[model samples]
Target: MFDTIDFQALRRIGLSQALVAQMFNLQTEPADRLMRVTEVQRDRLRLHDGEAEHVAQVWPTLRIALQMQGESLVVGDWVAARRDDSLGDVCWAAARVPPVNHLVRRDSSGLRQVLVSNVDTALLVMGCGQDFNLRRLDRYLALVRLAGVAPVVVLSKADLLMDGGASRAEAVRRHLSGQVDVVALNGQEAASAQALSPWLAEGQTLVLLGSSGAGKSTLTNTLTGLAAQATGGVRGGDEHGRHTTTTRSMHRCASGACIIDTPGLRGLQVDADEAQLDAVFDDISSLAPMCRFRDCHHEDEPGCAVRSRVPAGRLLSYHKLQREAQRHEMTVLDRQRQAAEWKARGRFAKAVSRAKRG
Candidate 1:
């Protein structure tokens, strides 16, 4: 099915070398062909075979090479590969390309985990019913902004808001900046699915994120025109979605774009950098430069530009986003300090071991 994939699109998504080799069916001659990786499992990878698809296991040599380079591969990466005589098949592989962009998060252990590499856009999906939360959207925006990808807010399950009252879209617009495009539609409707086609262009990679039962799987099924994923209903009392998607899976849309569906995030730990926080609170950042004092907190500062606009309501939203951004920045700093201390202790232990050996 991949015989006609757009090579340019593959390059744009940043496929790693080893996976790229398998994608082009060049595992037998790694030096000759390039392939892009569509998905990855613990020990195996699903690669595009130029026109079809194939699976390859990570060879020990490639694994060691990745470790040596301190580069971990993720989905949406391109790679190179070659056959291994010892494995009795074209099993050995290597990552030849590095990612142009990657979505990374700090795991509980303080290690950086790449969620997906080379994504073009992030679709922040939120259900219109009781699942909509402005603070949660702020968190998603901060996370995606750090990755340097475009963000689109998708208000799913719009059919639920058909009562003719204040629309869910209106509620979302109140919290979002006018610069962000907001799409409200029912995933079950074909017309609604078509609205998202422009972003699903061939070779592009988009990720769907929201709370459980926020209609991510439903939207995925609509876009793919098949029931490739399972869906569960929301809880009767709370209107919360069940954990229907158990794993992260990448699917190729008929339009040639790649879509990654992740399980609903129950808790989003703040693990982004100060730059990301600044991006999410751009209005505040802009005002900070105008403050009379460089260290203006905006609370009672004499020449606070941010505080000046708050009474007129122009900066109320900005102030709220600024507070959330500050909280996330502090959290990230705390995590980094903890990680540094752990590394220092490990080094100290190794030094003591060397002294004993001598």
Candidate 2:
């Protein structure tokens, strides 16, 4: 908690001109220091106030307000906070600046979860070992696309494969039809960071997203040039890794780019609608117009261009994603309807009581 915080290091964390303008216009407490949250813990948050990081506390009201709004302050969020000299020099955050974009997803319970915000790119890391699955990668691509973040596929653990994972990486690149750049590299090597240098330029912010034991932490350690993240061994049978990194933490690379490392997700439930999913899966989307019927499900439909052109496995993946997206939409609509019905019932009970009292 200090009296002043300048915006000199704001660009290092991908603070855009629009976000600066928004923070400047916000009417908050007497705080000139703008800070970025690097880590969010159960009780406290590690905030970097442009110069240094400080473990700061939050106003109880601030937390309550965010909770009621169904929002939480995540890593990569810029916040306005102040240090009170009168209160024994303690720090307290007042308000959070809205993020430019959010990498959002849903869990198995259909609960909305925002992965990270203010991201410029998503490094979808997948181990070339047993972790290589094109189906899962397609799901990740859709989630990143729906969030409006640029996606870059990173094939880690290349050295483990017989052919250095080149063939596997090429397959992924080909699977996506080269819509995005795919890089195959050994995550433990120093050169791996250089391979991702294009996206690590100054002012760029990236997030590493993959299942547990996909080498996210290894890549992060290499990028930061420090053994800051812990690495664990994978199971021999399934080649699956443990959840070594449990929390989300952001670290600055030597290139001045910021990388946010997250825990390996068990499953990614896409919180997207049909139109949004279409925007990500271009193969099916491009051929849908040529179908005999506009509502062609692509299953046993005569003259279905999508079914004819799309690979059987690829089509199956698309159908599965479509089903999930549709179910998420229905669940959301049901929740809204239930809320409305409850509100109507409350109003009706009040009206009846008023008539009886009169």
- The count of residue-pair clashes in candidate 2 stands at 0
lDDT of 2: 0.84
Most TM-score-accurate candidate: 2
| lDDT (C-alpha, whole model) for all candidates | 0.69, 0.84
Residue-wise C-alpha lDDT for candidate 2, range 43-79, written one tens digit per residue: 8888886567877777688789889887888998888
Clashing pairs in 2: none
lDDT of prediction 1: 0.69
Scanning candidate 2 in windows of ten residues, the lowest lDDT window is 1-10
Kindly report which residue stretches of model 2 are placed more than 4 angstroms away from their true locations once superposed: 1-5, 86-90, 331-358
C-alpha TM-scores of all predictions: 0.75, 0.87
How many residue pairs clash in each candidate at the backbone level? 21, 0
**Residue 1 shift from truth in candidate 1, angstroms:** 24
Residues 222-298 of candidate 1 have per-residue lDDT tens digits of 88788988998767876666779877777776666778888877556545555656666676677788999998877
